[model samples]
Structure formats: C-alpha cells, structure tokens
Target: MSWLTIARWDARAVLRDRWFISVAGAFGSLVIAAALVALGSVDVLGVSAFGRVAATLIHLGMLFIPLIGLTVGAVWIAGERESGSLVLLLSQPVERRTVFSAKYLGVAWGMTGAVAVGFGAAGLLLALRAGTDRIPAFLWLVVLSSLLALAMLATGFLISAGSPSRSRALGTALLVWLALVIVSDLGILGTAMILRLPAWAVLVLGSLNPVSAFRLAAIVGITGSADLTGPVGLYAADRLGFAGLLGALVLILAAWTGGAYLLGRKRFLEAVEG
Candidate 1:
C-alpha cells in the first residue's frame, strides 16, 4: 500500500483510540475553562481580554500539547511492533521510509487536529466576548502551539524507533517529557542560583529545549511578556529583534522535528532489517 493509505489507516486508528479521545477532550475543556476564567476579570480599556486568554492558553499548551504528542508518537511504531503488525506491513511492497513517514504524518495530523479543536473552541469564545481584533493573536497562538506539538511528537517517534518494546518506548517517552517539561526548568533554576548565569547563557540554554523555546517564543513574540520571561527575553529581543527571535524559534522547532524524524527513520529501518 502507499504511504497515503498507511496514513489514512493510522489516522482512523487514532480516532478509535480511547486515550487520544480523553486527552483531546481534556485539552478542549481546559482551553474553554481558561477563556471563561479570563473573561470573569474586567478588561481595561487598552488591554485586550483575548490577549490575556491567549497568554494563559499558551502556558496551558506548553504543558498539555507535549504530553499528548509524545504519548501518540511513542505508540505509533512500537505498538505495531508489539502486535506483530510491523512485520506484516514490511511484507508489503512499501518502503520502510514510507511507512515511517506515513506514521509520523498520521500522528502529527491527529494530534494537530486535537489541538485545533481545543484551541479553536477557546478562540471562538474569545471572539464572541472580545473584539475581532484578537483573532490574529489567537491564530498566532495556534500556529506556535502546533509547532511545539510537532517537535515533541518527533522526539516521541525517535524514542519509539529506538525502543525494542512498546512498554520501554512508553517509559522512555514519559521520562523524556518529564526531563523537558519539569527537570530541565529545575536544573536551569538551580544552576542559575549557583552560578549567577548571564542573560545570554540563560537564553542559550533555554533555547536548547523545544518546550522552553516554545515558551520563550510565545511570551516574547506573541504575548509581549518580556518582563515575565526575565533577562533572557530581553537579551533575545535586543540581539535578535522580535522578528528575528521568532524566526530563530521557528528554525529551532523545525530542526527538532526534522532531525528527530531522520534519526527515527534510520533506527526504524535498522529494527526492521534485523
């Protein structure tokens, strides 16, 4: 079968998966709740209520999207291997790379759809409550959030390809998620306290992780929350300018997705050949 067929099959499988449904539901609920809560507060004459909601949603996206993306991606290939479906698929005329690419696209699109539904619901609510001017900011939030999800999904695929079992792949994916989401921040805080890290150093270190890069980009680029991002944000804004920093963030996320896909494809091929 062709890669498109494989992608379609996998997409259908994702739709049937209970875990995906639960995660997507949770994401949507959270976004809707955030919008309602933000609206409860009074909007100042100049301040945009949609902007506040979008900022809150960005933080929420940072937490939720990566976890969901990783879970979906980790199971894509490893689950097939566990069920002996990978072998059957390989027996077909499809190239290994095609299979891998198809799986990635399927998972990526599935996760992106989930995110869009959640965030779109929130955006619609915001548009109703706030002015239409906020639509552009909401759109930017959607694009950046999708980019972050794809990056995390790529990392999950890498873990799945390298793991021998579905369980191991899942365990590794969780660990990777924890490292990027929690441990990395703690380490940076501790190191900064101990070493009195320079602003440039903090920016450099933060940009290394996709999650952190997403946060930096959202806060600095979309929300204009330079104060919240601290000196690192200022450094980025000063050196790279807002447009340049955004360009760099996009490049970093793209690199994460592309590099992980290439590496994962190689490992998947090796596993099938062996």
Candidate 2:
C-alpha cells in the first residue's frame, strides 16, 4: 500500500482508540475551563483580556501538549513490534521509510487536530467575550502549540523505535517527557541561580529544549512579556529582535522534529532487519 493509505489507516486507528478519545475529551474540558477562568479574571489591565487568556493557554499548552504527543507516540512502532504486527507489515511490499513517514504524519496530524480543537474552543470563547483583537495571537498560539506537539511526537517515536519492547518504549518516553518538561527547566533555573549563569548562558539553556523554546516563543510573541522570562527572554529580544527570535524558535523546533525523525528511521530500519 502507498504511504497515504498507511497514513489513513493509522489515523483511523488513532480515532478509534479509546485512550486517545479520553485524552482529547479531557483536554477540551481543560481548555474550556481555562477560557472561563480568563474571562472571570478580566480587568482593566495594561494587557488586553484576550492576551491574558492567550498567555494562560500558552502555559497550559507548553506543559500538556507535549505530554499528550509523547504519550500517543511512545507505543506507536514498538507496540506493533511487541504484537508481531510489525513483522506482518514488513512482510508486505511497503517500504520501511514509507511506513515510518506515514506513521509520523498520522500521529502528528492527530495530535495537531486535538490541539486545534481544544484551543479553538478557547479562542471562540475569547472572541465572544473579549472581541477579535487577539485573534491573531490566538492563531499563533495554535500553530506554535501544534508544532510543539509534533516535535515531542518525533522525540517519542525515536524512543519507540529504539526500544526493544512497548513497555520499555513507554517508560523511556515518560522519562524523556519528564526530562524535557520538568527536569530541564529546573536544572536551568538552579544553574542560573547557583552558578550565576550569564544571560547568554541562560538563553542558550532555555533554547536547548523544544518545550522551553515553545514557552519562550509564546510568552515573547503572544503576550509580549519579556520580563517574565528574566534574562533569557531579554537577551533574545535584544539580540535577535522579536521576528528573529521567532525564526530561531521555528528552526529549533524543525531541528528537533527532523533530527528525531532521522534517528528514528535509522533505528527502525535496524530493528526490522536485525
């Protein structure tokens, strides 16, 4: 079968999976709750009501989107291998690269759609209560959040491909998620505090993780809150400018996704052949 066919098959499976369904449902609920909280807290501040909501969503997205993406992707290939389905698929005429590419596309699209739906609900709420001035920022948040999910999916897929079993893959994925989402930020904060890291060092540390990059981009781009980021955000804004910093974030995400895909593809091929 062609890659498109494989992608469709994978997407269908994801849609039918109850785990994904539950996650999507919960995420939508959370998004709606965030919207209500933002609306309730709106005041005559320097920032617009919509900006505050967008900021809230950005923080939520930075944490939860990657988690969902990684969870969805962690068992993708390794689960198939564990079930002996990978062998059957390999026995078919489909090329290995095509399979990997299609699976990646399917997972990425599924996660992206989930993020869009969740965030779209929040956006509609903002538009109804606060007007459309922040619509552009909301759109940016959706796009960036989707990209972050895709980046995390790629990372999880790489772990899945390299793992020997589905359970191991899932474990590794969780560890990777913890490292990127929690440990990395804590380490950076501690290093900056203890070592008196320079602004450039802090900026570099923040840029190292895809999730951190997403947060930096969202705070700087959507909320225009450079001070909230402390040294790293100011350094980036001063040196790269807003547009340049955005470009850099895009590049960083691209590297994470592309690099992970390449590594995963190599490992998958090796696993199949060996």
Candidate 3:
C-alpha cells in the first residue's frame, strides 16, 4: 500500500472509466472549435492584436476548464464511498492521507494528459490553418489554460472528498462554481444599486473573485496587455514573478487537495465506525 501503488490503481481506474474518455474528447473538440472560429474572424495574430487573441483564449480556458474539471473530479472520492469501496480500500495498512493524496495526484495526472492531448491537437490545427503569427500565443493558450483546468479539478476533488454523499458533494461543487461565476458581479451590482458603492469598490470586488483572478491571469499571459493586466485578478503568474506565481498556485491547490483529503479521511472513519 505504497503511495505509488495507490496512484497506479487510481490511474488505472480512471483510464478504464468510459466517461473520462468521452469528456476528454468533448472538451478538446469544443476548445478547438472555438479557437478556430475566433481565428477565422481575426485572421491575424500579430503583436498588436495579441491581446485580443489572448483574451479569447482566456475566456475559453475559463469556461472549459472549470466545467471539465468540476465534472470529472466531483465524483472521485464520493463514488468510491457510495459503493463502500473507499472503506474497504482504507482498511488496508496504508494511511488515509496517503490514499487520499495518491488518488488526487493520480486523477490530476490523467486529466493533465487528456487535456494535453486535446489542447495540443487544437494547437496543431490552429497552427496549420493560421500560419506563424498566431503560433506562439496559441501554444501559450494551450499550456497555461491547462493549469487553470487543473486548479479547478483540485477544487472539485476537495468538494467531493469533503461531503458525505455523492449528490451533496457534486451539488456543493456546482454551487461553488456558480457562485464564483455570478456572485461577484451580482454582489457588485447589488451594492452599486442599493448602497451606491463607489465605482472603485465595485471594480475591486469584481477582480477579487478567484474565477476573475484566473481569467485575468490567463488574459494577461496571453495578451501581455499592460492595461488589461491591471492590479486585479490573480494572473496565473502573479506580479511577484513566474516562480512566485507557480509557487502560489501550487500551494493553493495543495491546500485544497489536502483539506479535501483530511475531510474525506474523517468521513471515512465516521462512516465505518459510527
């Protein structure tokens, strides 16, 4: 019951699941379709218009990554718990944290591989059709955007591992995502309407949401737009520098995964012994 063994088992399970394959195919196609369509409208990916392309790719990443990650990772722990397999698996000599961490890492590896394939394919298509100007930005879109997807997946697994029931876990994950998408704007709009908040305050609220943070970060990565890369939104790489941003994302993601695993471990103990 080593960590490597646990990861191997999780990876094999995910690969055997039919749904994972379908999800990968569907998401990859959607991204490629959107990027190609955007390319058609603009026809050029010059430095002058890099911002625009970057913005489009950012929007695509924001939309697709969360949707895919949330759905795929929502059932990771809950599904096993549902069938009593989680407890059985945990009954072995392995530590609960090891099992939890290994599963999280294993699922992440599968997701990363699938996304890389799909995005890489899309990049190739864009390259072949759009010529040289768009290549660099397009490639960046593929790589950086995948990072966002991975983060969302980590969050989803956190929710799944924390909740007792599969339905509750997935519901929580979806609600969290919805809140991230709409609550920020709604809160700002409500404050603006009710309290007559200052424009600056409302703007700040909009930028603080993680969804907005990731979106802005992706956009900044793609566009390098000085104006768009305002102080708001957590860029994939924060202003602190590339190493800093990577460290930040990794820490944040690790916190979420760790939190989820701890929660799941507690739940597993309660369910079996209670």
For residues 1-274, write the lDDT of model 2, one tens digit per residue: 4888888888878777676788777877887897888787565542366666776787778778777778778888988989998888888899998899999898787778878888888988888877788888888888888889889889888988878788998888888888998899899899999999988888888897999989888877776657777777888888998789888988898899999889999988887876
lDDT of each: 0.84, 0.83, 0.65
Backbone-clash count (model 3): 2
What lDDT, from 0 to 1, does candidate 3 have?
0.65
Estimate the TM-score for candidate 3: 0.76
Native-referenced Cα lDDT, model 1: 0.84
Better of 2 and 3 by TM-score: 2
Sorted on TM-score, best first, the list reads: 1, 2, 3
Error of 3 at 71 (Å): 2.8
lDDT of 1 by residue, 1-274 (tens): 5999988888788877888789878888989998988876626533366667877898788888888888878987898889898889899998889999998888788888888888888888777777677677778889889999899988889989968788998888888889989899889878987999987887878888899988887777666546667777778888988889888988898899999989999998888886
Model 1: pairs clashing at backbone N, Cα or C within 3 Å: none
The lDDT of model 2 is: 0.83
- C-alpha displacement of 228 in model 3, angstroms? 3.9
Off by over 4 Å in 3: 40-54, 132-136, 192-208, 229-274
Better of 1 and 3 by TM-score: 1
Q: Write the per-residue lDDT of candidate 3 for residues 218-260, one digit (tens) a residue.
A: 5545555434644433332345465554345344444544554
